[model samples]
Each structure stands twice: as structure tokens, then as C-alpha cells.
Target chain A: MDNSVLLKVNQLKKTFIKKSGTVFNRKKTEVYAVNNVNFEIKKGEILGIIGESGCGKTTTARMVMRLMEESSGEILFEGNNLCTIKNAETNRLRKNMQMIFQDPYDTLNPGMRIVDILMEPLNAHEKNLPSNEKLKRVIEAIESIELKPAEDYLYRYPHQLSGGQRQRIAIARAVILKPSFIAADEPTSMLDVSVRAGILNLLLDLRKKMGLTMLFITHDLSTASYMCDRIAVMYQGRIVEIGPTKKIIQSPSHPYTIALVSVVKDLNYFIENREKLILDGEVDSTRKDTGCTFVTRCPHQEKVCHSKAPEIEALGNGHAVACHCHSNWLEKTS
Target chain B: MSTVLSIENLSTFFKTDKGIVRAVEDVTFSLEEGEMLGLIGESGCGKTTVAQSILRLIEYPGKVVSGKVILNGKDLLKATDDELYSLRWKEISVIPQSAMNALNPVYTVGDQIIEAILLHEKVSKSEAVKRTKTLLELVGIDGERQKSFPHEFSGGMKQRVAIAMALACNPKLVISDESTTGLDVLTQAQVIALIKNLQKKMNLSVILISHDLPMVTAICEKIAIMYAGKLVEWATTEEILNNPKHPYSKALLNATPNLSDPDREVVSIPGSVPNLVNIPKCCRFHTRCPYAFDRCLNESPELREVTPGHYTACFLEGDKNG
Candidate 1:
């Protein structure tokens, strides 16, 4: 493990068991939502985890934040195993690591004032601080997010503000603790395009200003490329590819990564000319241990792809891809 | 080219305590046969209202104030209930946003399609079921799944069924309102491809309303950019993407994150969308637009053709045409 790594996740696995059959006789089946995932986030780096819905991107983030208990794995934060920490110690660890959720409307309490929402985390973590100090901190946090005239927004309810404003309030609340790490899961997916850029830029500015390391999760590849330093492409509970943002965008190694990059519509003329590899079929979340989760739709799938699971192969330059046809892609492109 | 649908100065307002909420105001555009037009805007920009108004779906406090919706050379607003009923599904249909809730859970997927076919056309149960199976196959769904309930189908499959239901009567025009907003990227691409393939096969005109500029650019040939209840810019997809005329349109382009071009700077508009009730008499986007001038403060700009094919509603471009 790298010494500069702020968060390290090793062989993370989460499974849900469901009982089937009549009330008289019950049977159980295990649903592996996330299976043996490994990745690391260095200090001050924005590591993006991207996948389709039900692909365990959100589950991975939740496990990393310790919001959900993992079935098996090790989550190391600053040389300490977070999964083994006591309740009190875990609560303290939360002060250094925070999470920003997907939907701003649901994440925020409609009846609470913006100040109250921002102060909840502060009050919980910084209980020793006086009332005046808490108020000052809330005001400062609101100002940092560029909410403007913090006094006016302090008394306003979440419904009174626009979607973008409410999302900013959410970010302000997350950063008030000055956490060393943040996990934002689909933060801007619900926002309008005009305001989404503002939120993305805000996150980037805050990362630079506070030196915060972040795990940004999203399905939109373009956004991940814009904000993240490196990206780990997840598909069906596995990291299919991981590399620097530039390398991943320029030369995507994995077939799934290629499909994702090809789908990003843009103004570039070359993209219009290039042939699109639209992946057919749907993501099956309920399937039992299948060789190559993407085999059902891979355009270049071989007989071996369906019979054997490929291991993560290092392609050099901090890039690693998990695929059986990676050699074919290298040979064809190079 | 013959025009399939023509909207002239269409305005819709909702009577609210705040005031008359002008959701869609003085919006005019024409859709030709076999053409796909993308309506792009924020949530409250009235893109959905424009689509619903064409189908006369505006109800209660929300009413269409003025303007004519001429579909197939007939005035939809002045048409009687019987006349409108004959036109719907056969002439134009709608695929709404929520596929999960749009379908009836209690009824099997086949029964719903049969009901739709029976509503517009006098068809027997057996014949309607046969047509329903064919429609399902056209949209890339197994005909065998027609017996299954909506809850049994996956999200992507449900969306395909919705598309199938919309095309049961072979409508010439289809209006899809953010149909793929909640789906995953891969599913979104599949749904889009399905729509495009159907459009080509049937030579249908489609009105795709969504806030996602990238998705819109991928499918639609022409695009109309809306802001604050008004259409600010209208042009072919290429023209709109390559050279946006309005500040709002340019800002939207800059705001979108493009993987193909990583070096482009992201320019986010300053403020949020303004309240639609009692909108400003001047330019609606003046509050957030960076190019607002003295004229933009006092007088509203009409949608004027700035180029041979591109149109924009901005004081900055007003002088260029003159």
C-alpha cells in the first residue's frame, strides 16, 4: 500500500441474503452486490468510482464512509482499520470523513433552516464548542460555499431555495467539519446542466482550498473526467479499469470502459466520425457467478471470455484493465 | 419539406397565489416530417409543458392562453373532443418521463396495449392482442413477455414496453419527455438507439424533451434551447453545438462536461433559474446571462433569425440580423 494513500479498500465484499419459499419452509439465497473490490485514494486526490445503477458504485461509497457495514473486507483510513473501530471511535472518525448524497431534496429536511442543517454535524462532532462558536462556524461554512450574505440564507428553509442552492447547502454542511476526506455519490446527477458545472467547480475549488481528498462517484463519465484526477471504472461489483483521467479518456483499455467513453456525446467532430460501440443487453444484477460479467454484450467476446474470468492485468503507466481481450485492443490500437 | 406539426406563439399559464405562472410563453416552432427536434432546458423552463400542450394535456389551473397548435394542417386547439380523440395515437402520441409509474401495475402489459388500440380504433380483443405482440417485438422486447405484469419487467424492458405502447397505432409523431432521465448510461443509450431505429423505420417525427444536452445532441437533428419559459435559441444540432448564438446557450454548452475535449473550460452560469410567476418584462435570462446590456433591462427580445437557419432571442444578436 502506498504511504500517501488516505483511504485503502482491500477485497471489499457485501452480500445480502434473502429468504425464499412459503412461511412454513424458508430458504435463503445470497445476493452479492459487491464482490472483492480493491482500490486506494491518495491524499488530495479525487478518485472517481463509476458504474451503471445497481453496479455497486453507491454501495462501495457507503461502505467506505462506514454508513453501511461490510460483510467482508478491510477499510483502512490513515493507517487504521475503520471496520474494527469501536462505536465512539467510529463516531470520531466520521468527523474526518464525510458524505454528500445524491438527491438534495430528500437528503435535506424540508422543515429545517439552512443554518440548522449545517449545524447538525457540527453539534454532533464538536459538542464542546460554545453556541457562539458554532454559529460563527456555520456562518463561515455557508460563506465558503459562496451562498452569499450568509445571514439571509441562515434562516431560509430548504424548500425556499432552488435545487442548486439546496445542493450547495449540502456541500457546505459536509465541509463545515473540515474533513480530510469526502465521498460524493452522484452529487450533480439530479441538478440541471446549467447549475451542475457550478457544483462541480465548487467541489474542485474546495478540494484545492482545503486540500481535501475525495471519492467522487457518478455514472456520467464526462463529469468524472472533468473533476477527478484518477478514475476506477466499476462494473458488476468489480473494478474493470483504473488509471489517470487523461489516459483513461485518451486510450480506454477495457471494453466496458470503451463503451462508456464512446457514449459521451460531445461537440468534437472526430467523435461523430468514429464508430460507436453501443453495448447491447442490460446489466444483470441477480446473476450467479458468471465468467466476465459483461460477456453477454461484449462486441469482441471470444469463447474464452465466457468460460474464464480475467484477472486485473497491469498495462503500465498506472493503468490496469481486467479483460480477456485487452491484448487484442492493445494490438489493434497500437 | 412538409410540416407535420406547427406551434405558433403558444402560451400556457397556471393560476397560482404568487400570480399567473407563465410556464410557456410565446413559444413557436415547426417540425417537419421525419425530423427529430430536441427541446433542451432546465426543469422549470416549460419544455415539458410545450410537449403536453400539443397533446392538449394541460388541465385545471394550467391553461393554454393563446396561439395555435396546427398538427397535420388541422387546428388542435379548435378541434372538438371527438376530432382530438381520432387524432391522438393515430396522428401523435406521447411517451412520458416515468416508465415505472406510467404503466398500470394491476393489468398485464398486453391488456394495456389492447386498451390503447381499442380506444382509438374499433378492434376486437384477439386482433388487438395480435397487434400488441407485434408492437412489442418492434421495440426489441420478447412477445412472450406480453403476458407478464409491469412489475415483473426490468426498468429498461418497461421503457421499451412504453415505447411499444406509444407506437401501437403507428402515430406519425411521438413526444418523449425526459424518457431516459433516471436510467443508467448503458440503458439510456439502448433506449435512445431504439427510438432512433423506430424513427427511421416509421419515418416519424419526434420531439425529445430533456435537460441533458449530450443525450439530445446524440439523437436529435435540430434543437431548441429554452430558458425561463421561452425558446431562446433554435438551430440544427450541428449549428447549435458548433456555434451557439445566445449567452444562455453558450453557457449551457460550456457547462456540459465533454470527454472528447478535455481542455475546454467549464463556465457555469452564476444564479439559478428565476421564478416563472410575473416574469421580467425584459430579457428573462438577464439575471444569469453575462451579456445583458441596457436594452436587455427594458425590453424583451423576440426570437429572430440571426442566420439563414439559426434563430436566437438576444439583444446582442438583434443588431447582427439588421
Candidate 2:
């Protein structure tokens, strides 16, 4: 409902029906991939969804991109409820939203040239544009992604380009339409640190130039902290903590957030005598749980955390956390 | 500490359809007893190739042209097939990059690790099984879970199994080539911490080949920075952190986003990693090196000891030191 909000997700849930046991003994179970996930990305703002594998970060992102249909709940983009919208209007919505996937090697068609890869979106969305005009725009898009001259890369196949180059072309493909929003799901995770930095900086630069709002999803906290204006830590399809990037990293409230932040190895000088919670095991999304999703792995879990789900409580300055034992951290943090 | 393993003038080339691909050329580094050496480079920079060349794992198309992989004063490269076979797993074993593909699907995780131990050492099935349980427990996995198949374990658990398998024979030297890769960040850190802890506990020499510079620098005592098939810099972690000699090393450090220093500018190195196919002898990093000079383009820089222990292969070492 907010004028500044570019995209808002309300209780967006996605579940997969998983069946276990043999022919004689069979049982079907509903795996909550994305359960009651809610967040909003303001115009020109980047909100990162940080979580480990199987934490539903990618699933939530796919629902926003409309690549995957949500089981229930609303995806509101610019005052429009995308879920309720007809199929005809959804096609038009595709023009404004695009997603950059994890693997660059698989995203692009190896057989297709860079020119054609950039043109496919345009062909689908803007069919009225003349052939030459489309070609010029493809070149412009290539140049915009900083693959200089554009001609050098336009004719080359995806196989010919390096991983970073392919990812840039992927970014080029995403932004060629000049979409208002981009859901980048671990775009640089596959890249080397050197090239990873280039991709991250390029995304940051593009955000400024294009005035783009991004729902950046990553498992790496350092990367999330760098790319996101606000960070949302996800565990088992639920947001454990959502706050300013600095607040999440420096003074994290949730135990999972603390663990995530502490685990990110950096060249920067280590914080002296910091309480590093090296929690064993990972957050499994499937087994079915009624309480807080992170209860299984939370180092500071209480009796209430196992029986009752904690509601998202505002901690001021747009920061919020869903943890029964958040007060323990708050006391220390204060 | 004594030098556990030393690679002298190692060169591995792949006879590709295009030409002779210089995958790892003149890469030299020594790992001391209980020392953790981080072999870092971009993809195709031949970090993995160097690891492969060490264990004589280079297959048909790729050949270790010339190198001396001296382990325990014996050149592994010159070792006969029988000798090399005997040495592998018993003295030195590799923890491959992908744990998913590393384990045999048909075998139980315990059976796989037990097989490795029994094959290397003169141990009975019962003895091997007991050791396997201990190994599994050592890597922070429950011993009972060893009976589970690879598919039964999660991505992180499978990787831990791989680590347990790698350590089964109690190899004096372990080559954990990107072991933490494909796992989540928290798991990656935990696995890395496990490796570091194991190295100290067992007094094992480790060669951790990866592309993650920050993670490498954080745990690895020494670092060998590679680029386009050449070892650009080899130094202590502190030296690499505070005073990196090679332009590639400095660029890598700069390019990495430091979590502690959030406001620090993350400047990416220009240009992609150079193609090694039919490449001439020159600084492999010249194309991406900002301080590249005429000499960098014309000739290859040999690894020189600029300081007591720090080594670098760059024309602009003087500039770096100054």
C-alpha cells in the first residue's frame, strides 16, 4: 500500500507434497518450502534474503519472479496483487520483473550468441520494435554491462565468454529490458572472489544507474551485508531477523543471525573476545515443525521456542526479529 | 618444522585440440609439517591442476611435463606406478572438490572410508570399521550415520564424510582441494574450522586449494597465490595480508569484500583470466595486473625470494615493496 514500496510480499507460502515409504506403507507429507514469508522492497532499495541451503531463500525469490507459483498469500507489485491478476496481465508484469540465477554456465544457452541472448527478452516483451532498433538496443545493453565495444561480445557464444563475462551477459539480459526490479539469487556464488567482486560492484553500479530495486538472495552473510541495504535472515522458510545490514552483522538479535554473521570469515581484524556461536548441523526445511523453524539449531533456544512460534517484534529503526530468546541478546547488545 | 612436501619447478600441460594448454607452469611451493598452505586462484588458473599434478592424478590429455613432487625426500613424479599407488592414501590423500561425486553411490559411507583405510593399511575389516567410526566422529558426524549411504546425508554431511574418508589412512599430508565448496557459508566455515583443527591435532600438512581468498587467509598459515597457471606469490598469511608483492596478490586482496572493513572499496581486477592455450611465456597476470609493464608482457618473471620467506613472480616487485 505504501507509494515508495516497489514490491510487497504478504504471507507468501510455497509447499511441496513429498511422499515417503514403500508401496505397502505409503505416506504423503507437505513440505513447507516458503511458509508465511513477508517482506517489502522499497523503490531503489535492495533487500537481501540471507539463508543457508534448503532455507527457502531461492523458493521465495522464484515466487516473486513469478517463475514458481506460490501455494498461498499475496505478491503485491506496485499496488497490484500479482496472485489475483489474470494470466493476460501477468505477461505484462513479466516486463518489469527479471531474475538472475545462481549458475552462469547453465543460465545462458550455450548455443546462442550473446546478441541473441540479449534479444530473446526483447522479442518476447517488445515485439513491435523494428529489427535493427532491437539490434541497436542489444548492443547498448551489452555496452551498459561494461562489455566494451559490444561488438566483441555480441557475436560470441556463451561458451566463448568467461564465467564472469557470462554472468555480466546474464546481468545484461536481466537489465536489457530495464526492469524496475531484479531478483538476483546468488549470482556471484559460482564465481571466483576476484570476479565475484566485479559482479557485486556491477550490480551496485546498475542499481544506481537504473534506479533498480533488488531482492538479493545469498547464503553468504558477508556478501549479503555488502549488497543489501536491509538484511533478512531466513531459516526453514521463515525470516528469523530483518534489520539494517550493520545492525544484523554487528548486533544480531537472533541466534541464527549471530551464527551466520560469526561464520563469515574475513581478512578484517577479528573482534576481540566476541561470543561466536558455532552451531552444529543445518536448518532442515522438511521434517514438519509447528514452533520456530530455527528451534532445532538455535544455540540460545528456550522451552517456548520449541512449542510456540515467535511473532515478528519490531526493535525500532525498521529492525525486527522473530525469536523467543531475543531479549537475551538485546540485554547484552544494549 | 620440517618441510613435509616440496614441489620443485612443476609444470603440467594439457594437449588440447587448440594447442598445448599450460595448465600449471613452473609452480613451486613447500608445505612444512603441520603447515596449512592455501593454494588460491581463479577457475582455470590451474589451482586444481597443481593439486592433481601433485598426486599424479593427471589423466591422458593432461600430463605433468616436468616437476618434482618431493614427499618425504622421494620424488612422487619419478615414482613407479606401484610405488605411487602404494604411497597414495597411505601417505598422501586428496579430499576432492565435490563430495557428491566423490563417493560411490553403491557403497555405504562407512564402507567407502573403511575400504580406503583397509586398502592402504594392513588392517582387518573389523579394525577398519572401528577406525572408520572414529574418523567419522572426528569430523563431527555421528559414527552410526556412517552406515547411511551418500544420498542419505545432506550436502554438508556428505562433505564431512569426504573429509573423514580423506583422513582414514592418516595421511601425513592431505590435499583438501576446495572441500568447503558447494556447502553453505556456515557449513563451509565449520568444515574449514574442522580441517584447521585436524591439521593442528594430527600435525598434518594440508594444501587447501580454493578460490575463496578471505577464507583461505583466515585459516591457512601460508598462501600460494596462482594466476593463469603460474604461482605468482607465496608468503606467510600476515605478509600476504599486510604486504603482498605481486600485483595479482594485491588485486585479489582488494577485490575480496572484507566483512570487518565494510566501507573499504572493493575494486575488481580488470579483464578476465588469460587463456592458456598456445600462450607465450610471459607474466600470466599481465592482462589483469594494473601495474603491468613492458617486461611483464615480454618475459615471464621467475619466483624470487624478495624477503626471508616471501616469494613473488612479478616485474613490479620493487614498486610493491616501496
Report fnat for all candidates as fractions from 0 to 1: 0.68, 0.69
Top-lDDT candidate index: 1
Q: Write model 1 residue lDDT over B1-322, tens digit each, in one string.
A: 7999999999999999889999999998989999999999988899999988999999989999999999988999999999988999999998989898999999999999999999889889899999998999998788988999999888988999999999999899999989988888777777887888789889999999998888888778999999989999999999998899999998889999887777676878998788888876889999887778888889989998889888899988989657
How much does candidate 1 score in TM-score? Answer: 0.95
Q: Measured against the native two-chain assembly using Cα atoms, what DockQ does each of the candidate structures obtain, in the order listed?
A: 0.56, 0.54
Give the local distance difference test score of model 1. Answer: 0.89
Instruction: Tell how far residue B237 is off in model 1, in angstroms.
Output: 1.4
Off by over 4 Å in 2: A265-278, A329-334, B318-322
Clashing pairs in 2: none
Put down candidate 1 lDDT per residue, A1-334, tens digits, no spaces: 6789999999999998877799989978877789889888999999999998888999999998888999999999998899999988988899999999999999999989988999899889999999999999999999998888999999999999888899999999899999999999999988988889899999999999999999999998999999999999998988999999998988888888877777774323223423335444666666677688888767777888887778888888889999998887568756
Candidate lDDT (C-alpha), each = 0.89, 0.86
lDDT of 2 at A314: 91
Q: Residue B283, candidate 1: how far off, in angstroms?
A: 1.4
| Error at A327, model 1, angstroms | 1.6
Task: Please report how far candidate 1 places residue B196 from its true position, in Å.
Answer: 0.9
